[model samples]
Target: MNAIGIDELRGLAMLPPTASGHSPFAEPCLLLRLGGTAERRLADWLRQLPCPVIGIGEADAPLAASCDVVVQNEQEAQPLLAGVRRSPVAATVLVQLLRASESLPVADALTMESLAYATLQGGAEFRRWLEGRPAPPVPPAETGPAVLLAREADTLRLTLNRPARRNSMSVEMRDALVEALQLALADDDIRRVRIDGAGKCFSTGGELDEFGTAPDPATAHAVRSLTVPGRLLAACADRAEARVHGACIGSGIEFPAFAGRIVAAPDAWFQLPELQFGLIPGAGGCVSLPRRIGRQRTACMVLGGKRIDARTAKDWGLVDAIESSR
Candidate 1:
């Protein structure tokens, strides 16, 4: 929660490193603004800092690489700081977030470790709040399909059909996804499974009103583990591709992270807002996202509730490619 000015940051870098090879302020999250000549000159020292540093303004490649987060403007830094302060394990969370900024090779085993850590350290109040909300009203069967399934040669296309709701992942949508994926798994002729959303967005995340509908946490955990579309996508990752556009939020981005190929439109943006709601990503994001971009970046996204643009997502290895929206 400490906001250090650029001058102070520069001074700290010049001081002697501790026996542990970390700066004196290394234990606390440091926030600062850097640009122009100063940023370039201090790039090496900035990279060597052992603490989490949130930088505002344009940074050279070396400095940018060293920064735990680089926001284009000062306003964006506020929410990230707020998110960190709200967490019970702020230092640990910040360290994880900072580690994500580092260049690390992706490994399945490492991703699993990240998932375990996320689940174990997630806020209990967030869980209780999410599970205490009112259940959502059921959509009528006559409302047409929440998910539309079709075939085109070897490819099976699944479109989220509820444009009015921005294709929120309602119960009906989840069921439809499960069924379509199950069919795709059984059919030998279905060589590819392509997922897309109708209207403006890929999705606005899970329907908020539906939180806490499950009778108990145990049942909810079972459903999330055994029947969520994220699991289905993970099972057939090699054959699955998600063409995402617009705002891909919460479950929107989490589910697609499990796919082998994610083709995002130029205008697409990704975000994880679950932490703002006082909960971790409940829709398999902790597992799927860390697997794609490494746990550190995943931690940054979740803990900071930051919006990552399509280009950033591609650069971080979250999406395979960026293409025009169809």
Candidate 2:
């Protein structure tokens, strides 16, 4: 199978929509026709294109040069199409292919046309874009410490690597965990997630070392008012799962509560000591936790700053179940 790196594809994919200004004789377009096996694949790559491309038989050879890339052979074309069927770039295939060829096979050509139209026109549809959301930004996978690896059968397992500071949620760890959770939500393979702290404790909370001087309240308010990630978390509320052990606190609880299920170790405890530091759960904990455990309970946990054991959490319905032991 022929494949192009995303970087190279980005560069090669910049062909213009129309070849009007260029020399009419110059070959600005390319034509692609695949044998039975590749019919779908050839159609798909064309669909991702921002410019239009026509089939060789439907239009004369003039449009073929406009095609920057084409699969001359059918067998090589199948996988590319199947892979791009659900992509946002699929819509641009026809924008990549102008009105040149009607002779193209009906089914594949129609599929390409539909994809092109959507990519070109679906920008204003908020939910459509959301449905095709991109991967969350995260750190490169290689650099971090390796710690606890949490896994459930057929579910997701995340290795909480930072064992040094009682597994406090370092910025790297937080961003990585968030990115991992987002990926799990997008993946059909992951049905549940297990979160365990490295070393002795489950978590001490956010990496206080990473917490800098607080941003100006006005600035913080302005950002929260916009509510970007919060809205995204709201949308993903029903899909993720978490299993926690040891000292789950602050952002530890905040992040996990977004999961659809929460299971903690028998000795594991829950707390939101953010109030003591004059802060609240900044990562949707204020909203998510209260919704699950209730306001009075959330208040007592946050304001009272008292620790609640796993069974107490189970009684309050904070956690779904307690693990048998460490």
For model 1 the TM-score comes to: 0.68
Candidate 1, 190-217: lDDT as tens digits = 9999999998999989887776566655
Q: After superposing candidate 1, which stretches have Cα over 4 Å from the reference?
A: 2-78, 89-124, 127-142
lDDT, candidate 1, equals 0.71
CA lDDT of each prediction against the hidden true structure: 0.71, 0.50
TM-scores, all models, native as reference:
0.68, 0.49
lDDT of 2 by residue, 76-139 (tens): 3342233223231321232233222233432333333333333333333323543444543443
Where is model 2 more than 4 Å wrong at Cα? 1-154, 213-239
